[model samples]
Target chain A: MSSGDHTAHVHRDDYGSRMGMWLFLFTELILFGGLFLIYAVYRFMYPTEFHVAAMELDTVFGAVNTIILLTSSLTIAMSITALQRNRKTLSLVLQFATILLAISFMVNKYFEWGAKFGYGLYPGSEMLLDKPSGEILFFGLYYTMTGLHGLHVLIGIVFIGIIMYQVWIGRVHSTNYVRLESAGLYWHLVDIIWIFLFPLFYLII
Target chain B: MANGTLYMPETEPNYLDYRGRFKGILGWILSTDHKRIGLLYLYSMGLFLTVGIFFGFMMRLELIAPGKVIIEPQTYNSFFTLHGIIMIFLFIIPGLPAVFGNFFLPILIGAKDVAFPRINLLSWWLFAIGGGLAITSVFLPGGPADTGWTFYVPYSIRSTTNVLPAAFAAFILGFSSILTGINFVTTIHRLRAPGMDWFKMPLFIWSLYATAWIQVLATPIIGITLLLVAVERLFGIGLFDPALGGDPVLFQHLFWIYSHPAVYIMILPAMGVISEIIPVFARRTIFGYSFIAFSSLAIAFFGSLVWAHHMFTAGMSDTGRFVFSLLTFLVAIPSAIKVFNWIATLYKGSIQLAPPMLYALGFIFLFSIGGLTGLMQGALSINIHIHDTSFIVGHFHYVMFGGTGFGIFAALHYWLPKMYGRMYNEKRAKVGFWVLITGFNLLYFPMLVMGWLGMPRRYYDYLPEFHVYHFISTIGSWILITGLLIMAVNLILGVRRGAKATDNPWGGETLEWRIQTPPTHENFHEIPVITGGPYEYKINENGQEEKKYEEVT
Candidate 1:
């Protein structure tokens, strides 16, 4: 990352960087997209079982996590706007807020999953095994999708944390903040995938 | 290293010998030079390819006369699985794009380097790790996965072999592929030299652009699918478990969803290489430039829709089978357009059958056979017959080996001299080509024949009736290896001590030809301003010489 290291600094295009980030986000979407396809097929095959399985997932936890993620997305977006306006303090604070929200989302997820484990209702559990196969598949997808989403949240927190350090170091300021913007784009994608997952898993009838 | 007086005075050192803060091997592994990274891929891929070829050779030796030629049946199962994994993921999947694409994409488009140089290096590292994990699986507690490269479920889940590591290897390799795809797509879009419009870029760039999109979009599907498989195996996730009322057929759907389009990821860039070689060696502009370029996009787009053809015998709805079968047939049109255009480019032109052109022409011949047979298997009835036969094996090797393998050789021969500032021995390179081609056809064609005559693939033993075809195919493997050795030696010798090569050895009209023989770390002294199409060769209509377009200044 030294200026003398290589040609990465010679001709940097923020637009190109953003485009690369978007393309990467597309790959992320499709990765979860494959999981969603499986979810839909199974839900269709076992509707009543899926309905019964849906009841097991506490909507309060799902709704609380959804709102937390949505607010974090807004904070991250505002953090970029603040950076663009050269309000470094505001940007850092908003970034911290976003990171805090993401952590809360994870905390909510841990408890929700913990509750299920207490009930012995997880994948391959004896209780879940005694239930219908459709219910087994529903919880399987619920764990997989939310677990993957939670991992992304952790990664996003780390990503934003690093960007926060960069911002504090004055490396990313008003004039050069594509790194910040790219991270924001990734965080939003994480949020958007949750938007889809929440209604599909928690709100399913 | 100068070959002629027309060359300009050298300023910076060529990429090969250039040293940075990190010296020697560290310089290469840590350096972000696209050319150096390309060479890294080449050397690493070359190593893995040799390992893969050894596995293949042993398999062919095993199948030489049917019963117990070398390894036990379990060992044979592991060998074929490892062979498919190593060859497809390690060698061919990332084959042309990773090696040649990284080396030349920036240069071809008149740029200094790829869009994300660090990510480019990261991709190479990930590739090495993935390949390492795959090879290491064989030595792991259980032998390598016997579930084939497809890693079909139920068996993949039940088999106690080292499926986890193999699956993880494939998943990690998928990340490498996606990163390269992102780098290339962004580089092509944002880094094209000024005045180089989309239509004005080289056909190879066009093909890379299309291939990059597929790589980005399709590879992730495989990533998640494999992860699901691994999860099913470890945690009993039951997503693909039939015992849990999960549909195993869904795994096939998800796997092929990425994998079938992955065929395009392998071949489209090969087609791009052929497009570049054909016009350059023929000493004429490419025929139907837009058609050939558009055909690449067409192939990438339609190639995605036909994954289900692989599942025809997996009991798809009749309507689903019909749709996929039709899409498979439709996909053939764009490929045919390319083959026809290449042939027409050769027609009535003063064609130079150099080592590269020889391989390119051979690609055209072999890919056509591979492709047409593919259409045969696309038919629902025919697919039922040849679904798991040696014919399926023959069909892929012909296309994958004959098509992409030759394309890689052609690119190496065509570009390596420029990369190394030395020419390979023409006679030896040609001799290598002839031996390789003859051995290639002899090795694979019989598999196609025996497959038609009911020879099942992946079998350690076969019926006596299929013995002759297997025997002939096994001998073909020997010839093929000899030819490969000849080519490898000749190319290596050429790189080390061959005659100094001129800047534009084959009279190529692309931007790569305009750079130094062995390009400096920064490809162009200053990026050129392009003003015309990539293949704008001079024409001699009615014996009156005429230039095609305003030259890049």
Candidate 2:
């Protein structure tokens, strides 16, 4: 209802872009939260079958991807610090490291799923479908949750590559870095999802 | 002017008269100005509402006689689906907030536009694109989504229609909603003028804040849930297919987590508009403004917890039923507090029965009945009896259509003049209101009675016992449509040929009324500092009232 000084201030960044990013992250959390809820309910319903299904997933692959995503998250986090400290080249190197880790994570997922498909364990396959319905349900959650996570990792890699391009051209710099920070936050979220997914889908007994 | 060099004439170029970067329709379609975006929403929503009305008309006509009169059972199912989807997503959810909130949120908070102007424009385009996809689904190769708007699990996954595009349409619309939420929350936090603080803001902004949070937090759940349903159909995911060990109830859980609070999203803004209108028309500061404001937050919080009330008959455990039923009742407290405050504000006040005020009053009466019936359904025992019956249908209409629908109607009548700088025929507006009320009550009331008599909903035909009630309801539809035409025609004439509106049309004390009618593109030439509350009508030293708004030096 009240106004401030009538002097026209040229800086129109009344709302910091970082605030918008944080708000967007809230939505991303809820999006995965839905999947987690489905996981919880279905797991409770068929605890024995879910446990059996978890045993079939190769923990070696799950563990390796988790480590890869965790390291990528760290690199992306450090890259923001590098950019903020005005080390442009070091920032780009760290960004490259992060994308490399994301690619390895996806490549690991491909072989794991390829092996499962080799055994005819893919969703709706006769071998899995012929098993107890709980096993089908268990595999369903694993694929949907991990596949959705993979999509995010892929999107995060593209997003970081774009940010790196912006940094190289000086469009993003030490003083102007919300874009890089947003991309970092997204990468960390993808990492955190893996952190949870690794245990719930692969480690849980 | 602050520098004493600039001058503003009474006939300065209004927002409508001013042109932007693009020309012709592109200027409006692509403009980042919040006002123009608001108008874009209004025009698009109006078109969808007409289509929605036609669907409802067909359904009611088919129901006039119990059997198939114009279409078969399958077509009737699709008819209801189209009607529900169009009304719920395209109209009610976005209606008030998108149209009025966009236009006035910045102006009322004393800012030029929302925090992110380009993002605001993007949200509208998303909405239009989402709406277009949904409409296209109606005629696509598969012949529309035959699943009800709820799109309950296995059926939705198994439907032969174009479920993917239709469900994706709602999913894409969620992005539009989420972006708007981020914009509004940031705007209210950052854009308020120097003297304006959280407590000093209007009730409408407070309600929008609550609604925005739900949009931000809860909408994603439904978005992802809908995506899962689409995935199940596309791939045999069996996520919710009972035959595949998937739980159908889980789908309801995910869906209602967003939608249950979505009811508040639909109604809270309407309540805010009524809060604005009642105080202005009654010429009083709102009764317990803080209470009304806090009640909005309360409704948002508790509304989220009560989603399972909709699932009581879906075979939820007894404990879950008990907890959800109690939470549902608790949400009613805040909504009722708002109704009480509006009534208290009107007590012994200089009440003006303008068209907008009449609509607000109608909203209160209709929403109260809706709210009471909601409480009735919230009770586990009562809900079991009326579950899936016409009573549930009646209750939702009283709430969603009667409550939120009339809220939008009231807002249209109230704010159209401010946007266009012209007033509608007040006398004709009153006549329209009376007929609309009679028709609305006639339209929905029998459903409550017949619902108690065990007339099930979603049925294409009914036994002879339910015939009388069905006939009464169809007649009510005719009356309601007649009244709607009158109101629509009156408002159209007001825009085309009515006289100009003054700055302070109803002695409103908000910041928008203090500025030029219809407003300029940048809103204010220079921001004014406030020294008092938004609704105070104070007496000056001469024992007379001062200007409705004043600038502090």
Candidate 3:
């Protein structure tokens, strides 16, 4: 490696940046963890309600969104690898593609939520359907979970956009791949969260 | 390099060169230096503490007579709610660790700076913003929040108070804490000087590491929990509002999951401080270094599980109560281990009886009593009688106030010379220590007795029988406040004109004392590798010897 390429050799102190990200992810997990626990307890209490509520959600839409997210994750992973192989232009292209895919997933989510809203399933609105207690419980989980996941998708899109800028500006390259790796880790987490979200909201029913 | 002995010069005026001092007021406001950031937290927390104390004193004055003396009952509720909120979140939660820990942890560990100094600065600013918002809630149109610090839901939902601002402030403060935790964890993991292994690291860093874990892993739940409460309050959502078929108890669970570990977040660093002070004054290796270090981690690990103990009276099942109570008792074991080890470290060593040592000793005695009382409350049957009573309040005060508060004072005194390059009056410090400890017991101990006598807490007024205890507690509070005032004044004066401190005023073997009184921009002249455990104090053929590890570089 060139002597100017300081980032290639991971400084012993570099763990701080990585560890900070890991701890942040830990906090994010716990934040989402509490909601998961709530979902678990409520689901256990009202299985039939959850089942029916799960059925009401469009599986096809969710499945499409999942595919979009998964594909974005792949692009992000490839971007990191492209940067690692000194293919800066390729990396930037991949990051842009990832951001585009993330935005598309969010667009799909907007439509899906809009359809639910049209169906009188909006939380606290007059249009909210009068369902069994279990179904209401399921809807509560649905809104809270999907709303939170949507927030994550928005955040992911922003992060990818920033990464795209960094790559375009030639700040990211093979030697300086920590940012890409960190961003990839976050993108992968978003994908992993959707893996769970898909089965719970779409497949399990 | 040169036996790995960290040496800081005495007449090094350049060491105190605050880089942003040239920027004038803006320098302090926008500076990213950890020292300045720590001072910012100190000043903000000090202001909040004063406000909290004012509210507390008002409560005490109101109780001076059987009826309300200065304010109406609604005002009284707001006063006490602000008091609890400010004291718990604004002051004590960040009390020492945010102030001294931020200032000294990196220096003590011999690193150039905290791993994330910019984030460190951001945490303090967030704290200031949160504190400002919380205080502003006092004058809002609907009056201040009256749901107390815990903010239990249905009442919180229905109460015509400015609950949103207060809850939002708390949510923001949780973010500050999480950021600080993230910074500290990374610093401890990556910033240790070469050869400063986990076991050789100062107990303070170990405690901080554990505390940071709680901040990172637990505070977010409270953030979400508070946000949900705000959403419920503002938009009429019913997540926590039990009147709308929501479960208030679920709020309790979410709150305690964070709040329970939060108690440890308050004390673990105090325990770390006491460990540091004991070894320096006792002139010996800390008894059971590994155990003390691991106990901190153990406490952090177990602290999360026992949060359910707080929910015992919230109508949990018998099996749930049984499991929680048992876990609660188990949590105290690590604490007990720490107490035992501290005493053992002091067994046959030369004890200096300095002011810091005095406070450290006070922490041991008071924290022990507090921990034991906590165990008493942890018992399923006993908690039923005293769950919402003054006894529970008393127990927490002893732990939080007596334990964390006393430990903070100990650290202030211990590090005062190092931080400011001056010596405080020994006579004044001793008097302050004794007065504070005496007044602290007087202030809180009687509430325990009255709690047992069936006196409920948070009441504006009480029956005549409870008056005697309230009067005593109030008087004691005055004395406690006076002692704190004396301590603060003397230390401030001491910093300006006191005798210049030596490189190692206490002859302590820690890396912090090895540096200048006020450390340099870069803490060390040459980064010193750790050659010994922090508390190694023994004699060998090489004059006075200590356990020395190798230098990695």
* Cα deviation of A121, candidate 2, in Å: 1.9
Cα lDDT for residue A150, candidate 1: 90
lDDT of 2 by residue, B1-553 (tens): 0111121655457888876556788778878788999999999999999999999999999999877789998899999999988888999999988999999999888888888778888999999999999999999998878898999988998889888998999999999999999999988988887688788788999999999999999999999999999888888976899989888988998999999989989999999999989988777788998999999999999998999898899999999998999888898899889999999999977777888999999999999999999988988998999999999999999998889988998999888878998878889999998998899888899999999999999888999899888999999999999999999999999888787876667767778877777888777777766556777643222433323212212
Per-model TM values vs. the true structure: 0.97, 0.95, 0.94
Model 3: per-residue Cα lDDT over B275-330, one tens digit each: 99998888878899999999999999999899988887899889989999999999
lDDT score, residue B516, model 2?
79
Interface root-mean-square deviation for each candidate?
A: 1.9, 6.0, 6.5
**Lowest summed-lDDT stretch of 10 residues in model 1 chain B?**
B544-553
Clash count, candidate 2: 0
True contacts kept of each: 0.68, 0.66, 0.38
lDDT, model 3: 0.82
Q: For candidate 2, what is the TM-score? A: 0.95
- CA lDDT, candidate 1, residue B170: 98
Top-TM-score candidate index? 1
- Per-model CA lDDT versus the true structure: 0.90, 0.87, 0.82
As for candidate 3, its clashing pairs are A49-A134, A49-A135, B531-B548, B531-B549
Clashes of each: 0, 0, 4
- Identify the runs in model 2 with alpha carbons over 4 angstroms from their true place: A1-15, B1-7, B10-12, B539-553
Better of 1 and 3 by DockQ: 1
Q: Largest DockQ belongs to which candidate?
A: 1
